[model samples]
Target: MNWYVVYTKPKWEKKVAERLNQIGIECYCPVITQIKQWSDRKKKIEGPLFNSYVFVQLLDMDRNAVFQVAGVIRYLFWLGKPAIVKDEEIAIIKKGLSDSNVSDVSVTAFQVGDRIKLESGVFSSQNAIVQEISNTHYILVLESLGCVLKIKYK
Candidate 1:
């Protein structure tokens, strides 16, 4: 059996994985737990690491069976064929997400000349160029306003 990638409906990764499992199909959905803060309180919740995508290990005969499950959109194709994922790649993804300190995993790595946007705070929605990186802050040069701001890394 080989691992193949399947696309699911929006926010339906878990549900689709469950349905596939119930039908005796093996599937893997990598998720991570994070603390979500709201105005009233904070709660730790599990969310998909790869949004709307799930991996399934199966034979060629089971292809149609997987598609029949609810919330399953279609198979992820590459170069006119269904993309086959390597077992080692999937294992690495699972192991990385299973770590206790997954929160420290940087989703995006910025370089010296990369363009980045401030997601929150006073400079929210503003674009800036990465100039330097200190141990605790990012020195970004905002060319539009002609100012350099050293924003603390969250």
Candidate 2:
């Protein structure tokens, strides 16, 4: 069985993952705990790390089994086919979340020449220099990865 990326309805990642697992399908929905403030109080709430996305592992023929659950939009596509997530990538996410050494993960505004180190994801620990910035995204030149990365934000 291979891991495939599943796109879910907005804010449905955790619910969809729970439903898929209830039916015996292996699913992963990474979550993070943050302090959310309202007029009354500041409370710690857990939320999905990747909004509207979950990972499911199943055989190619068993792919349709996920659709039986609610809020599953579709398999994320790449190059006209369902996008696959490598097992190592999934492990990285799990390890990052479990490792207490990793902290303060945030997407903040960066200047054109600021140097930053990625705290999570595939590029964790890699140093990148900001090359460009915009309202919705930023470009980084990852020296160690030897690649230019464009990250979209809102």
Candidate 3:
């Protein structure tokens, strides 16, 4: 078993993960907890850590079992190929799951106008100015500290 990055269609991370799990293939779709505020109440919800990718473990399974999953785009790769993930790291992750509050760890879509706050590390106070956006994390300009901090959009 390994952590192979699975490409999925838009808004289909959960669907793909579910389908893969149904086939006896283990999958890890990391998610983050979010709090939504309404008129008078705040509710917490879980969302994907990565917007369009999820991890899965495959064995001698036929391609039909994989390609048939709903919303599956393909395995992430270069030169138009399916890239395989190694097993050691996957074991590390599984170990962490044994005793941690592991959230769905996926890529985050950091966009403009998204308000953010410092959660930890050096500049854990001053507001984070979203200077740039990327696939995995957001590049923030910490004005108070006079340095740029690239924080994972967790």
Candidate 4:
């Protein structure tokens, strides 16, 4: 089994997942929790990590079977070759998602002395040491400042 990208029809992401499940195609669609505001109050819900594409694992021979699923527009490919996601990367992502022995609030772990770089933000392309880590922020000691900087970067 290998990972392949599936293109869903307009506004049919969930429908495609259901159809694929019915036909026994293994798929992965990670969702993040979000809060929705209504007139009176707000409610929490899960939303797709990606808007229109989902990953599926299936045998190479099941090409036609995949295209038959409702709401599946097509398999993304290049030069007649199916787009493939590496199994190792998929395993890492799944393990991170399914860690039961963890805190209620997800906290990304960072090494205190590990060298790291950031891109696209106020500190774009800056290297720093992770001095401390919070649930939603990184307390990094910038190379230039030599003092700790509390950055709310994901």
Deviating ranges (above 4 Å) for candidate 4? 78-80, 99-154
- Model 3 bad stretches (over 4 Å): 38-40, 60-64, 79-81, 91-154
Best by lDDT: 2
For each candidate, what TM-score against the reference? 0.67, 0.70, 0.53, 0.58
Could you tell me the C-alpha RMSD of candidate 3 in Å? 8.4
lDDT of 2 by residue, 64-144 (tens): 999999999999886568989999999989998888987644434468999999998788899999999887678999987
Candidate 3: 10-residue stretch with minimal lDDT: 102-111
Question: Which one wins by lDDT: 2 or 3?
Answer: 2
Residues 59-118 of candidate 3 have per-residue lDDT tens digits of: 645544667787988778633545666777666655765545764444455577566788
lDDT of 3 at 124: 71
lDDT of each: 0.87, 0.89, 0.72, 0.75
User: How far is 32's C-alpha from truth in model 2 (Å)?
Assistant: 0.6
Whole-structure CA lDDT of model 2: 0.89
Better of 1 and 3 by TM-score: 1
Q: Give the better candidate number (2 or 4) by lDDT.
A: 2
Number of backbone-clashing residue pairs for each candidate, in the order shown: 0, 0, 9, 0
